[model samples]
Target: MKPILYVGNINYSSWSLRPYIALRWAGIDFDMVEVNLDQPGYGDYAIAEILAFNPAGKVPALRVGAAVIADSLAISEWASETGSSLYPQDPLARALVRSAVAEMHSGFAAVRRDLSMNIRRRCKAFGLPADTVRDIARLDALFAGHRKHAAEGPFLFGQRTVADAFFTPVATRFRTYGIELSADAQAYCDTLLADAAFLAWEQMVLAQPATGFSRANIDRLYT
Candidate 1:
């Protein structure tokens, strides 16, 4: 049987997008199960549904037969095992990619809290908190540094990799929040935003039921 990817609100769940993009980039076929997290009884009903498969009650859990992978980063790692495209083939390059992916998987608290991942809405933000500003600077530096070494392609490591998958949502956040990036970083952001798999996810958001949280609030969540 094909694996099933359990996800939450696609527009807001950066975690869900990571593995979804990675698998699609790797050309691995899998079915998706979207758990409703915006409706009433979210604590009782939605949480229960997620807990059916993931004790953490988080979205983007993967089910492959009897085994369940319960984290987006872990699921992306699974997709990378399929071929050399999801990660670089060279040892040093692969390690660098892993470090990039890991940073996205675990860090960037300010961006997550302030910007959120509201793909359906476009809004401008100004005079952001200090932490959020710092995060954006870090993003610019990271993207610029990666693009300099990206001799093979537009993607960070020259070709599509899990690092790109992990950063795609952040790219969207930058666009949605109107955060400016350096010329090099902005070029990389353009490449990520225009990716086919990323576009497919956006289309999916467009097609969700009216009740779905595919439509997000335009307002930023931070002070």
Candidate 2:
């Protein structure tokens, strides 16, 4: 089966990265189609074509044969079901992983807004809003709980899962924005940055033709 994923710029498109990482991590083969998000025709031209597969007219839509899947959660679920090891075989473990991935999909709105995902652009170090800070603290608590109860290897679940892929872009946002993270979270971020799949993705991102916006600071992320 041929799978095509419509995505945006790698340096900034967190949603695109979610399914991309999930597929790559799970060894699912797919083609990528990039859309110029900064252009004026994004909504009418780029998004309209995307809407043929995804009603939301958004990037990161997954096209599998005649079926179309929109939204990262849906796409990732499809990846898991098809050929990816996005979740665990164990029922309880799979449930735990799904819960974590769902929280990442729906929660952390403040962190997302305050610190946009810019893989290539390092921004001025800024503090988070009160609620976002609270959210980060909550994340730290969650990680700690995982470490205490469910931890096994470098990742939250000892093996890479959809949960890690979901948060991978958030880790990039924290790195780009220079958020002050706790030791556990920082360690987690380091593990993600060092992943071979993520490194390969970063190299592909660097190889893309330069877009004028943020061209000045794009190379810093790879080095």
Candidate 3:
């Protein structure tokens, strides 16, 4: 059986996108099972099914044979350990990558609540709050720093690392929301948008037959 990941609608599940991006960056093969997250009782049975693999009852859980891994960061790390150098191999570089990933995981609550991942739709002024503004500024600063340090390639630390995976959704959010950014930041976003894996994953998300997503909302961001 192929390794499987249980996820919610790709149009809105930012957390799920993290690991999906990582797995793809690592070039690992996996399967996807989508749950209608907006539907009632979406998880009662889904939880049970996934708990047979991951007890957390969360979407974005990874099933690798009998080994169950839950949570995006954990799954990304697991993917790194299994096959690819998802994180930087050097100790110091690995530390920097992990720090960036942790910052991504722990911080940005404001940005998350303000700009929920709605890929199929867009919103204007975004109604973002003051706190979210502060957080966004901070994130931009962090990304700028990474870009300066990104000597090797377009990726955060010269190459694609777990840190890039951690922020992949944020990159998408920035694009979807029409958030204007600095040249460096915009360049990083371009790299992510240009990634074949990201594009493929996005195509998969957009192909879902769900309804209610508003293209108008999304267009306003770009306009």
The most accurate candidate by TM-score is: 1
Q: What is the lDDT of residue 66 in candidate 3?
A: 82
Residues 100-130 of candidate 3: C-alpha lDDT, one tens digit per residue: 8999999889888667677666545556779
For candidate 1, the TM-score is 0.91
Per-candidate Cα lDDT values, in order, are 0.84, 0.76, 0.78
Show the colliding residue pairs in model 1. Answer: 153-158
Candidate 3: C-alpha lDDT: 0.78
lDDT string, candidate 2, 51-132, tens digits: 5667777888888889788778788878877875677679998899888888888898877766677776676554446987
Per candidate, the number of residue pairs that clash is 1, 0, 3
Q: Write model 1 residue lDDT over 1-223, tens digit each, in one string.
A: 9999998888777889999998898788999998777765454534777878987777889999998998888898888786446876799988999998888888899888788887876778777899989998998999999886667899988888889999999999999888889999999999999999999999998887534342344342432
Q: Rank the candidates by TM-score, best first.
A: 1, 3, 2
Question: In model 2, which regions exceed 4 Å deviation?
Answer: 41-46, 149-151, 209-223
Choose the strongest candidate by lDDT: 1
lDDT of 2: 0.76
